[model samples]
Target: MTQTLEVTQAAEVTQAAEVTQAVERPLQTAKPALGRGLLLLMSVATGLSVAGNYFAQPLLDLMGRELRLSTTMAALIVTAAQVGYALGLMLLVPLGDLVERRRLAVSLFGATAAFLVLTALAPNGSILLLGTALTALTSVAAQVVVPYAVTLAAPEQRGRVVGTVMTGLLLGALLARTASGALSELGGWRTVYWVNAVLMIVVAVLLRRHLPKLHTPAGLRYPALLRSTFALFRTEPLLRWRAGIAALSLASFNVLWTAVTFLLAGTYGWSEGAIGLFGLVGVAGALSTLAAGRLADRGFVQWLTGAGTALLALSWLAVGAGGASMWWLIGGVLVLNVAQSSLLNANQNVIYALRPEIRNRLNSAFMTAFFAGGATGSALTSIVWVSAGWTGVSVLGGSLATGTFVLWVLERVRTHA
Candidate 1:
């Protein structure tokens, strides 16, 4: 009887050990934590890379003059870049899983740097468009780095790290406008691209030397990998829900920014410089990104989503009313900025949790949808502003915000039920 009891106890202990290892193996295989300095480097690299797409936005008029193109033709410079970026997001970002991410990202940086210089050297409008397209396509380098940040983090801290990197991306985009405007005014529009090219070179060197080479497990062939993205969307209910929220929230945010320029200039008689400066004010709100991440780390996604959607909706009230007062406008803009960052953090928190191995594809799908929303909102703003005027545009933006709030409510009710 004693011998039988000892054998049973040994079996039970062995079973427990196997269970523990099963639970721990995934975490153990995840990439190790990145140091603070390297994380910061990743953030900086991401920011500079994304900024490549926006450099031409404020320089269109100057380029038009130099290239002997009409205003309509010059505007396509920004459009071409944006289209290339969207294509790269879908086509290239997924490659992160199939290759050494640091190698891929650095090579893109070098390629984009060359394209930026090519853009600056272009003698005609056709060449200029070609260079711009190529530059923005490769600038998706930043998107690849995002999943690299996630893979470097522990499962528990993934949200926090993602937030930090996103904050850098947002800030860089905001500053890009301001810096481009200032530089184009002081030097020439071409100077902006040249300076950005040099920065890209520096980032490439830094990444090659300092960024860790994260291991890539064997992956599906490129075509199968691309096809799998669609399968993920079909299967992942949470991905669908989070993606819908991202699209709606981003649309609301873009509607406000796009239409507000018309309001500031027409209603308030603000100068172009003063209007450009509003991008700086939006920076104050981007600070919410890190806080949003921490909230996600603490498992407050649903609550954050509910509250963020509400805040975004309410901010439109101030936005709609701000036709009367500049202070009201500024307050609404700040709230709008904070709410967007929070909602973005919340959405990313959910999607990043869904699949660890396919993170790049997940981010690509989410970001691509998010960009579509922005494009739709931009198009809508043009029509709404022209047809309905200020009141009409505000109502449209407010509707988009309210739609998000409604989506959150439905999600909560469904979960509880």
Candidate 2:
């Protein structure tokens, strides 16, 4: 009787062990190494995709003048693009899990090319706004490429791979304005759209030739996939928390950039050309995301995030002083970029680690939250800049940063508890 009982207990233990091994085997299995060429190509694809939303920012004045728009009405062009991107993040990015990612990405670039032409050819403000919105609506191609990159990378290397791609994404945002400014100066604002139209086709061809096709389960139907994303907010605590942090961090980042333009134009009387160069300054911070990605792999994610949020708060103090000193503003914006990039990378690392299969959907949710915050910050800064000026804008941004730190601390405490 004793021997029979012992044999049964041993069988139960073996079954549990089998279950554990089955789960870990996938993570332990060798994943193909991502080639440097693929990484570079992916980076460029992501950058070009994201550049669609930002191209109009520097060209807003030119566009407004051409479209016969009032100042208040002209700003909507940028807002329309932002809103379109947020919508795409929610509606379109989830399709990555359902379809072949390479196809989806290539298709997005092609569609974006069409819309860019529409924007370039727009005869009036309304049509131009529609074209810009459609371009951004399809340009969530960057979001598609990012999660696809994560899937191709071995589990251990996901952080570094994601970081490298993000560098391109950030650089695209930084450089697009400069390029738009130059193109607009040489030709007209419409020239920027025409150039990007051709560029998007080139990008699509490059991506189609190089982007890897991963073997994922056939994805859910569209509605279920999207429904699953919002359900994630309820089901996954980490996703919700990370999304909030991203939103807050992005909100603070937007507030600074939005208000800084006013400070340069109003206080320093800087030309549009000079004002455009500051985007270059922020590129330094974007480059640091690669290091931040490596650090995420080394562990200490929480520490890195905590430090970033703290710096974000502290950077605001320097930014607040920018009203008095140009050096302070330069130094502060650089610090702000570092803090923002690092924190965002850390947040993605954490969320991406949570549920591997639905990375695109998870990303869709995270980025949607992020853009929503950006839209908020843009709207808020416009109001504050008018009522309180630079000082008021600084205080508002600082308070948002401080709130970000507090949220980070509370999360850490709660996680530990």
Writing each residue's lDDT as its tens digit, candidate 2 over 1-417 gives 999999999999999787566544433442463688888888988888888788898888888888888887778898789878888999999887687667888999999999999999998888988998999999999998888787778767777888999999999998999999998989999988888889899989988777665534324688888899888899998887788888888999999999998899989999989999878999988999999989888886887799999999999999999999999999999999999999988998988888876788889998998888877887899899989999999998988888888888878788789
Worst 10-residue stretch by lDDT in candidate 2?
A: 22-31
Model 1 C-alpha lDDT per residue in residues 1-417, reported as the tens digit of each score: 999999999999999787566534543654564878888988888888888788887678789888898887898888898899989898988888677778899999999999999999999999999999999899999999888888778778877898899888898888998898998887898888899999999989988998776655434898988887767779887777777888888888889888888988999898888888888888966788899889888989888898899999999888888888889888998999999899998888888877776788888888888888888888899999999987887898889988889988887777688
Candidate 1 runs further than 4 Å off: 1-30
lDDT of each: 0.85, 0.86
State the TM-score for model 1. Answer: 0.91
Best lDDT among the predictions, by candidate number: 2
RMSD of each: 5.1, 4.0
Clashes of each: 0, 0
